[model samples]
Target: MTIFQVTLKNCAFYAHHGVFEQEKALGQRFFVDVVMDVEAGDALGSDDIEQTVHYGLVYELVEKIMTGSRRNLIETLANDVALGLTAWSPMIRRVEVAIRKPSAPIAGILDYVEVRVEHRN
Candidate 1:
């Protein structure tokens, strides 16, 4: 079994996702990274995209989730992305979803708050 990899990094979105009301109202920038291990099957050599997960579909899935609704936690966002990846394609064996909140409502100076979730078959 060959493990094929697909990664989407720095997928950015502006959305309302946070615990505080102001944070929800104002919205913020979020960066999402999705990595997957997939069974390439024939697509590895056949050059047929149908045998593997189409990354465009994956990006659309993430976009729908990131821009469509409001969530209070990046944890939930990460988990949802992981689950969605698996559900989107049976070829996916494992997935890791990372979400970075640049404008996290923290008092102190920091880079960002990130939440990551991993899921497997």
Candidate 2:
């Protein structure tokens, strides 16, 4: 038995998710990266879409989660994404979700604030 991985990276979404009142009101861009590990099984040989997890569906799920609600912490958001992806596909043995806040309200000059979360069956 072999394991395969599917990754969706740098998925950008603009939403209001933050602890600060100003952040909630102003909104900002968020980037999400997801990696899903699945048992290759027949999918590897068959080359069939049905045999493996659909990447588009995963993207849609991420988009829904990112735009759906507001959370104070990126950690919570990443956790939600991990859980959501795991639940979305039974074939997914493990899921890694990373959330990046580029315009986070910070005093010093920085690239971004990021949080990574993982979920496994």
Candidate 3:
């Protein structure tokens, strides 16, 4: 047996997803990365997209979730992305989602804060 993996890295979105009212009202930038273990089936040999997970629609689903809802934690965002990806396509056997928040409201100086989550089907 062989394994096929697909990755979409560092997709950026602006949204309100934090623990403060200011964070909710003001919003911040989030970078999302998704990796999936894909059961490509005939897609690997036949070059047909229909036999695998559609990453374009995957991005759309991520966009919809990020933009449509207000959440208090990036952990929720990560979990949602992982769950959504696995649910969106039966061809996706497993998924990992990472969310990076560059403007996290912490008193320390760092590159960013990230939350990662994984889901398996």
Candidate 4:
């Protein structure tokens, strides 16, 4: 089948998500990326809003997951987000999600921690 891709990358949000007490209390920024594959025919041919995925709504869903609560693992969060998107629309066949934590508490200085997950329904 033909695939239409939608990617929301480097989405930043402030939330309490970490393993440390201080990290949870202070709260920091998290980044999320969502890639969705959907049926391409109708959206590509008609160019109608109804025929395609609404990216804004996708972003809103991601934002809700990001700022909603304190989850210890990006993997769990990513999975939730990916599954959520797939559940949102029947046209969507697969979803890939990446959650990045830049301010994670680590032993030494580092760039960031991230998790990528893919889901199909």
Count of backbone clashes, every candidate in sequence? 0, 0, 0, 0
Model 2: CA > 4 A from native: none
Native-referenced Cα lDDT, model 4 = 0.86
Residue 94 lDDT in candidate 3: 88
lDDT to native, each model: 0.91, 0.92, 0.89, 0.86
For residues 25-109, what per-residue lDDT tens digits would candidate 3 score against the true structure?
9998999998999886888898887777888999999999988788898998889878878878888888999999999888999
lDDT (tens digit, per residue) of candidate 2 on 1-121: 7888999999999999999999999999999999989978789889999999989999999999999989999999999989988887889999999999999889999999999998998
Worst 10 residues of 4 by lDDT: 38-47
Q: Give the poorly placed runs of model 4, Cα more than 4 Å off.
A: none
Tens digit of per-residue lDDT, candidate 1, span 9-113? 999999999999998889999999999999979998989878889999999999998988789989998888888888888899999999999888889999999
**TM-score for candidate 2:** 0.97
**TM agreement with the true structure for every prediction:** 0.97, 0.97, 0.96, 0.93
lDDT accuracy of residue 117 in candidate 3: 93
Predicted structure 2: clash tally: 0
Question: TM-score of model 4 relative to the true fold?
Answer: 0.93
Give the number of the best model, judged by lDDT: 2
Error of 4 at 110 (Å): 1.6
Candidate 2 Cα lDDT to native: 0.92
